[model samples]
Target: MFRTRSDKVSLVMGHVIVTRGIAELPAVFFTAIMEAVRRFDDFTEHNDPHGEHDFGALTVSGERIFWKIDYYKRGTEEGSPDPSNMVLTERVLTVMLAEEY
Candidate 1:
């Protein structure tokens, strides 16, 4: 599934308890999502407790998939800043199936 990283992906043949920014993906996926938004008229973002800032949920062949981002709020030092906002202190994108976790 990660064949389209545009050479940004890193492969690791090991395990860890936690990791950050270890995955790199292509921007084309986002383009496709924007296309889907224009075509399907689906809302692309949501707010929640788990830091899921910009959330993209799509259904394909009866399977639900998601694309989302986590961000840090600039001032109060809080997590889960909305990715659409221009003032995020940090941002990270994530892609996964609904049931993967």
Candidate 2:
């Protein structure tokens, strides 16, 4: 989810949460997320190459300082009965205005 706040944006998913405000995040954080995603893809390709993943954003709390994110995977096939297709994978990141109050 992506939320715009007076000072920052909050991104939440499951038990993992990340907040992006008017300040910059550590470079290591960005690097870690990218690396994890890349590794996940590698693993998934070996285990389930035909699986597809997606991420989405939602607004909450008057569209200020709060947002929700939903990540999940689905079968690559147009129609499949794989339960993994309905599972949430993870929340990647949240972005906020750099100059917002």
Q: Point out where model 1 deviates above 4 Å.
A: 1-41, 44-53, 73-88
Q: Write the per-residue lDDT of candidate 2 for residues 1-101, one digit (tens) a residue.
A: 32222245443433234445413446765454434432332224544454433332222222322222334343232333442332534333433322332
Clashing pairs in 1: none
Question: Highest TM-score, which number?
Answer: 1
- Taking all chains together, each candidate's TM-score versus the true structure is 0.37, 0.23
RMSD of every prediction = 11.8, 15.9
Residue 49, model 2: Cα distance from true site in angstroms: 13
Model 1 collision count: 0
- Best-fitting candidate, measured by lDDT? 1
Worst 10 residues of 2 by lDDT: 58-67
Q: After superposition, how far is residue 31 of candidate 1 from its true place, in Å?
A: 11
Overlapping backbone residue pairs in candidate 2 total 4
